[model samples]
Target: MYSISIITVGMNHLAYLKSLLHSLYIENHPKCSFEMIYIDNCSKDDSVKFIRENYPEVKIIENKQPLGFGENNNKGVFASTGKYIAIINPDIVIQKDSLDILLDYAEQHLQAGIIVPQLLNPDHSIQYSVRGFISIKTLTARILSKGKDNVNNKTVNEYLCKDLDFQKTQFVDWAIGAAFFMHRDTFAKLGGFDLDYFLYMEDEDMCLRCWKNNMPVIYCPQSTMIHNHLRGSSKLGKKAWLHIQSIITFFRKHGIKIKNSKEHTMSL
Candidate 1:
């Protein structure tokens, strides 16, 4: 089997795709055997044609219609023949051999069901990629004036793991799905992402399930990647509504967990 399958799903993100492909194929220079899989969700632009012409080595999965983030990534994982899988977004640019670093960490940390590199802004500042699991209070705080109050800020930060040291490798409640690396077997056992969430919170749901099933989500600071994190609109819009709905579904699946003492809450 290939060492890893780097899967990126895009929809009309040609500009981002160009940079991402360049980073992976040229700048990255993977150490082990790996396959590049790009799942195109029926983009009207020339995303498919560009990859076909320039990067013929990439395996393309063209969708008949646009699918959600989870579903699209699942298609790539299903097609992967690699021992490990890297599900990254098209907007993420590889940095400093980040994929190899995460791969090494995953191999050493057998308990990690979800292994992620530190996500950074273009200026190289660490992004708050890791977050504590959401609770009723956490959701309430966000909805009520976007956590402006101190009490609400504290509640929100608790979910965001604001106090954690970003420079260390540790166990986190969840990491954003934008750049997740994990064993193929572990992901299969978890049954991929829940299709119930079309966009948001699927990453949170996946990480929560990992802990429930004794697979810890790990954050490795040794490896880092740059991500274009879109802090979605706070106003009640299509994206915001999806985020709210996913929160409800998450709570429904697993009742209010106000901070489980059994699970590792901080760095290991």
Candidate 2:
């Protein structure tokens, strides 16, 4: 069995953490095959004490200074002893057999560098999880067309972001960072998520690296999880402006030309 390490950065979501830990502990897999690592991001609340008291088996990294998503996960990854790495969010609860299915898929597809499971909303509705390559046009359009909601017309087009059917496996540009899994070797070769991103775009950066390295980012729909997205930033005053900044930053770093080509830029 491939060793798997589950990494999570905890915030103030204690209730969700309880549920997540319960789900993970009760999972019927071989206990020796997997380990859980929680990097508490200096939560002001009682998150640290809660984990230490409740989940003594977890290897806890108490962060004195809060590190963003990229850095915290990097810290956990470096400390992990697993051959496979799973970056799971505290708010998400994966299906019981999801990890087994994902591992099976990974074993079958040797070229699959990263695998994203089907993500669903709390209501069990399919969440548009996988995405296509990034550029600048799609980035700009995403900011300009905020809340112009249409299920059939999602902003991303390259990797078929609108496709929610979880019946088949397909290649995609990137998967949502909410819950992601990849081989430890592939992660090391790609240098992991770019720490410069701070919070976002790291997953897209990793997917880009996988693509550039001739490894495919896979969407395995057979395995699925529930993503309880907060959309906190979207409610902020400068949500639109901040999104634009990230979009431009993505294009500038990737050297994508927006004026001449019609390629989609990842903005979410």
Query: Considering every candidate listed, which one attains the maximal lDDT?
Result: 1
Per-residue lDDT tens digits of candidate 1, residues 1-268? 9989989998898999998889888998778789989999989899999999999999999999889888988889999999998998999999867888988888877777889889998888777778877787777777775633234367777766778889977777788888999999988988998898898889988888888788888888988889887566455688888888888888898888644423555344
Clashing pairs in 1: none
Residue-level lDDT for 222 in candidate 1? 89
Each model's RMSD to truth, in Å? Answer: 2.5, 4.4
Residue 123 accuracy (lDDT) in model 2: 96
Q: How does residue 172 of candidate 1 score in lDDT? A: 77
**C-alpha lDDT values of all predictions:** 0.84, 0.75
lDDT of 1 at 50: 96
State which candidate has the highest TM-score: 1
Which stretch of 10 consecutive residues in model 1 shows the poorest summed lDDT?
258-267
Model 1: how far is 261 from its true place, Å? 7.7
TM-score for each candidate, following the candidate numbering: 0.92, 0.87
lDDT of 2 by residue, 1-268 (tens): 3378999999788888887887777654433378889999888889878888988889989888877688899999998988888999998886868877777777777777889899888999887677666655565555455533342344544334664446777667787788888889888988887776666677887787777787777788888888887565554366445555665567777778422112323211
